[model samples]
Structure formats: C-alpha cells, structure tokens
Target: MVSSPSATPASALSAHAITAHMGPCAILHDIHLALAPGRWTSIVGPNGAGKSTLLRVLAGLQSCTGSVQLLGRALADWPRRERARTLSWLGQNESAADDLTVYDVAMLGRLPHQAWLAPPSSADHAAVEQALRATQAWDWRTRALGQLSGGERQRVLLARALAVQAQVLLMDEPLANLDPPHQADWLLLVRELVARGHTVVSVLHEVSFALQADDVAVLAAGRLRHHGSTQDAASHRALEQVFDQRIAITQAAGMWLALPRLERPAAPAPSAAAPVSA
Candidate 1:
C-alpha cells in the first residue's frame, strides 16, 4: 500500500526552489521536496542528472539557494553537532581510514553523542552491535577496512550510517557494489528503518528498486520531472521517459518489475553472388 504523508509526522526535511551550482554549471535548479518522517523516498535519473547534488544539498553539505528546513527549523540555524545528530549521510563513494577496523568505523557514528576523550558507552556498544547485525556485517567487525571486498565494505558503511540512529538518513547510490541478494537485504533494512519512524532519502540507479519506495522523485537535466507515490501513473511515465524509453514497468508475481528493451539481432545480409564480378 502506498504510504501517505498524513500518516506520518510533520516532514523531517523540506526544500523549496532549491538551486545549487558548481562553477558555471547548475547542478540543481529550482527544486522542491518534502520528506515525511517514517517514509522512504528515492531520487532517480540518468547520469549527471543532479541526483547526487540534491542529496548533498539536503544533507547540508553543499551550498544552495532557496529554503531548506529540517525539523521545522532552517537547516542553517542548527549547530553542526545538532545537525549531525539529526541527519546521517552516506555519500556515493564513501572512503574509510584503511587502518581502522570495521568496528571502529561503525563506532564513529556515536561521535555526536559521545563526550570528547571518553570511550564508547554501553549504549553506544549496543547501538554499534545492532547496526552491525542489521547490516549483516557483524562477523567482519574486526577486519580492517582495506581488507574487505567492495560489497562487504559497502555493507560496513551502511552499518555505520545505521549506527547513527538519526531521524533522517540520506544515501547516494547505496546499492553500487551489492549483489541481488544483498540489494534485497538493503531494501528490507530501509523498510525496517521507516517502520521505526526514520526518514530515508536515497539516490538510486535501480529503477525497479526505487519503485519499491514509498515515494519516487524523477529528475531530468537537473530538474524534477515527477514526485509522487510509486503507484502513480505519472511516476511510471516519468521513469520511462527519463531512461530514454528503454525501460518498461509491469506487474509480475504481484510486484512491479522494470524490463529493459533488448535489441533484436540483425538478419545476415545476403551474400553477393561470390566472384560473379570476377
């Protein structure tokens, strides 16, 4: 069933006419979005479509024009530590200190709540353990970041974000290195987070996976093309259009599936009367 904003608390994040530019290029232009608490929203588009830029702006990591409110207050008004406690961000290609163990990296999420010079508290330990287990990275907690495979490291990064237990989570290309099974696990984890009253906004390349979100926002050429429930007909049309009409959405096994167009093999050309000219 499509989740409605009425069912959630006031929006966790809101943006209006938000514009961001880098040098002479405008990465995001006049965008508006509202993320309800306990909902999952996916922003999707082709490459250079500004999906990542928008996430960064929403996370307050980039400078942008227009209004951005978090928890009903201007985002800029929040202190850094307070904002960190409210917003957890996972960038497209996150880097970790290679020497740090997975456990140490995940524990870093507690920095906003911890006293300076103090070690991790019991609550912090519990949160870290739960996050690790939730992301299925508990077994690799002792491994150094440089030792894990790409997919394993990605899971550990997700564990770190979850360990924050923030009200709003922003993730970009979160499924980059994950296999199908792990992708499914990630979806389940997102749903669990929303069920627990956390708000999630992710820039996802997988249209099928994005379609599973409570809401979908399609961007094209740095402009929002559609923003609404996944079940909306307009959302599907926008999804198809943004992908250059190569993707078709259909129902199978009671689930929405994105099917890509396959090119037909060309028939062999008839051979000219070999050597007829000779």
Candidate 2:
C-alpha cells in the first residue's frame, strides 16, 4: 500500500539484524541500516537484489525477524496512525480507479488527518494543492484518471503520495514512465524536501540519480555492500563492484555520473568462401 500524506517528528530510523524470507526462500539477511536524520538517502542495487524488500521492511509494511526503530521507539510499538503520520510511501507501478479524477486520488493522502465521514479541512485542501502543484499535476486536477497518459497518471499517483506530507518519505522507482524533464523535476522536489529538513529514502534503478542523494545504501545479492556518503571513494568502488564493473563513476558537470563501460565485440572471423556460385 502506498503511504498517505502526513506530518510527523523528524527522526532517524534504523534496523538491527534484520532478516526477511518468503516461504522457504530468504529475501534479505541480517540487514542493518541507519538513515541520516533530515536528509535524503537512496537504496540502489541490481534487480532481485532485495532493494524494494528492504524498503518495505524499513516502512514496517513487511514482517522480519529483526527489530526496527522509528523516532527512538520500537516500530511495532507505535500506533498504526502514528506510523502513518511518520512514513509516506510511494510504490512502483501503483494503480488507481479509472473513473477517479486526479483530485480524488490525491485527496487520499489526507485521509490520515481527516475524521471518519468528515469533509476535508482547510489544511487538507492546502496540502493537496501544494502536492499537486509540486508534481506539476495541478493542471489536470479535474481530469479522470482513465483519460491521462501513463506519465500523467504517474504524476497523479505521486501527487497522492506527496499529499500525505509525512516526515519520512520512502519511494520505489519514483521516476517510472517520466521523461527526462519530469525526472529532473522529481529530483528537484527531493532536494526541496531535504532542504526543508525532511528525510527521504528511495530505491532507484537509475544509478546517476541515486548518486545525487545525501547518503547511499548499496546492496548486492541481498546484502548491504556499502552505506555512506555518496562522495566517499568507498561508495563508488562498492557501486562498481556490485554491477560487476560494467560501469564507471566519473565527474561530469560537477556531479558524479555512472557511465557504462562496454567491451567492443571481437572482430568477426574472416568469412570462409567455399563453393558459392554467383
């Protein structure tokens, strides 16, 4: 489930000896992560590396053997509403009702703050408006979800998550279906959130974008290979090794860029001309 908008205390979250499994198959192993307070961190790894699973564990949406702490309290000890206020999640490939308007979907984020069967308060409207605008979806507020293109629908879903206004935001592949310009907008929004002292954690497939975060958690084969500031030489080395050294991190335009290192195909063997008739 995607998290609703919320306003909770800005605090650090961490895990101790966390392990997760699905039936007989283990998905994560003794994972430990300490997220920086009031900053942006990204979890990046190859497919099937447990990146999304780890994010779910941190959000308390998945069961695990280890313990998780939120704002200095056991995650399980917090009331559901309190947890909702503290964490806002944006998941990959989220779906909404085709008949629902963009405004209706985004308003869901305000549910945690509204009374049962009650109308949206002034603050609720303000938050939704702000989120929609930030995601550049305000122009289609009244449009039905079914009418929008894939990228537009993605924006509406993001607006819904943003409306929650939670202190700890966790997103999985927030840039899916977005063009380069909107992807840039998403990054800027992340920067704005961090600037306002909010903590953001994301699982990104785009390594270059992930490198821009304040801190990084690099995972490989379901284990934490490295966790530190992105600028650290150790982080870059870990990132390269995780991808089997198929990419090299370099400085370009004053920012770190992940450039793929492709090996040229061997020259084709000389063709053997046998008894071919013209």
The global C-alpha lDDT for each of the candidates, from Candidate 1 onward, is 0.89, 0.89
**Candidate 1 colliding pairs:** none
Residue 200, candidate 1: alpha-carbon lDDT: 93
TM-score of each: 0.90, 0.91
Each model's total of backbone clashes: 0, 6
Off by over 4 Å in 1: 1-9, 263-278
lDDT of 2: 0.89
Location of the lowest summed lDDT over 10 successive residues in candidate 2:
1-10
**Where does candidate 2 clash, by residue pair?**
4-164, 5-164, 5-165, 6-164, 6-165, 6-166
